[model samples]
Target: MMSKNTQADRNPPADKTAGQTKPRGKGKKYLVGLPITVWLVLIIIVPILIMFATSFYKKVGSNIEPIFNFGNYAKFFTDSIYIPIFFKTLLLALAVSISSIVLGYPLAYLVSRKVKRFRNQLYMLILVPLWVSYLVRIVAWRAILGRGGVLNTLLLDLHLIKEPISLFIYNPFAIFIVLTHISLPFVFISIFTSLEKIPKNLINAAADLGANGPRTLKEIIIPLSMPGVLSGFTMAFVTALGDYIIPQQLGGPNGLMFGNLIVSQFGYAYNWPLGAALGFIMFGIAVLILTLSNKASASEGYLE
Candidate 1:
């Protein structure tokens, strides 16, 4: 019996399997991230570096040179033409954002709360315009708002005005209308997501606690959906601020945005450095606004 036990114990230690070993320290974690790291460096990091480098150069007699001058930036701040255009663009973006929110919230709430079976259908309808080419949409609006367009015809039939209003086309009003229509889906979708996240139990709980419909909405639904509202407004604002095509097509003269100015600098003006500077300035302004909005949301206890 002792001899048999000794033999068995001697054979047991003959081999240890590879699967029995513990994993080594930090095994290949960075390797998994290598592709993403390369992509970010290629796409985002390199472009930003190029933009920064370009901002310091100047166009001199058909040649772009690395002058290391602040002339571009200085011109941006001191030039009367560009500065006012920048402010106008900011105001226009703000107006578009606010108007989109005002018009979108109610529609989103109604779609989310009131429509159950047709919710997907309604969402599809809202998003259908996006599937069409953006240029086509702008052209369609132009046709509808033109002098001999549907609006003018309706007004003429109704006798609202003796003549077709030029204000309806090729003006700031046209820009505002087109931009708001383009941005409405974004706001609506954001708010719809927030509305969907609200628990029915919370509404029931509020009702049971003797809170009326308006009180429940004001105290609970509105506060809970603040993050989505902020996100929607931010998206709408940024889109409106950067949009050049809509303003260019629908806007006669005063509807020009900073985007138009930037494009002109890069195109006919041949002022690459100034365009780069303006782009950076716009980036800084957008970052500042987003940061302030985030802080305000946090202060209001709406951010997690």
Candidate 2:
């Protein structure tokens, strides 16, 4: 009976379809991803490929010649004017990023740790500015900061100034203020998310060890939250660097950024190849920033 059972088990009752079917989830995932994959390829990957390819070509009169050369990047390096603007843009972006962290961190802490009941309300308020049109906001800032506008009128009414001041709009200071304000909410959201995920037991453990508020924050909270802060900085810096509309709206010739140079190449200058080259360089820089930040975060995590 045991030998018969063993032989029957080894022979196995086989339905004709026993190992013929494929896994079920693979088909579903492929179908779900098909549209998105196509969209990404057409809209993103294809354009990037075209841009990179175009960057290698030469623009002659109204036409682009298929002459592969590094002249575009070379021109950017050789020109002293654009080179200084690039450095200045880097500095400006850094300043905006740092300012966002400084301004957003306390606000994030207040919402996440202090305001427990109405934290959602606080976050919504932080994001309220995003609901407004960016162009509209810039226009509004122009009105508020313009000569003989809201600020000047208020100052005049308060008898604080002799006449309208042109210090608020059409300058580097205005661009910095606008960019920092625009970036603040994003920075706050990132920090608040990180701060919220911190283990309460760690804080309590430190407190039990006679560590005061500031000391505990310095040693525990800051170390844990540094990842979020770096992320916020990198995002803010990238946004600031890529901005062209704000600079055009509020910046004079003297306050122009690297974006304007790229714009000029594409626009009236009619040099699409050079514009593509500049864009690729910007992309490379952004990728480098993300790579460095990721490496640092990984190293910090390992050390901790």
Candidates in order, TM-scores: namely 0.86, 0.87
lDDT of 2 by residue, 25-58 (tens): 8789699889999999999999999999999889
lDDT of 1 by residue, 135-247 (tens): 99999998899998888989999998789877788888899899999999999889888888766766787788899989888977787777778878988898888899998
lDDT over C-alpha atoms for residue 293 of model 1? 73
Each prediction's whole-model lDDT (CA): 0.83, 0.84
Q: Please tell me which predicted candidate would have the highest TM-score against the true structure.
A: 2
Q: Which stretches of candidate 2 lie over 4 Å from their true place?
A: 1-34, 302-304
Span of ten consecutive residues with least summed lDDT in model 2: 1-10
**Cα RMSD (angstroms) for every candidate in the order listed:** 13.3, 11.4
Off by over 4 Å in 1: 1-32, 298-304
Q: Which ten residues in a row have the lowest lDDT in candidate 1?
A: 1-10
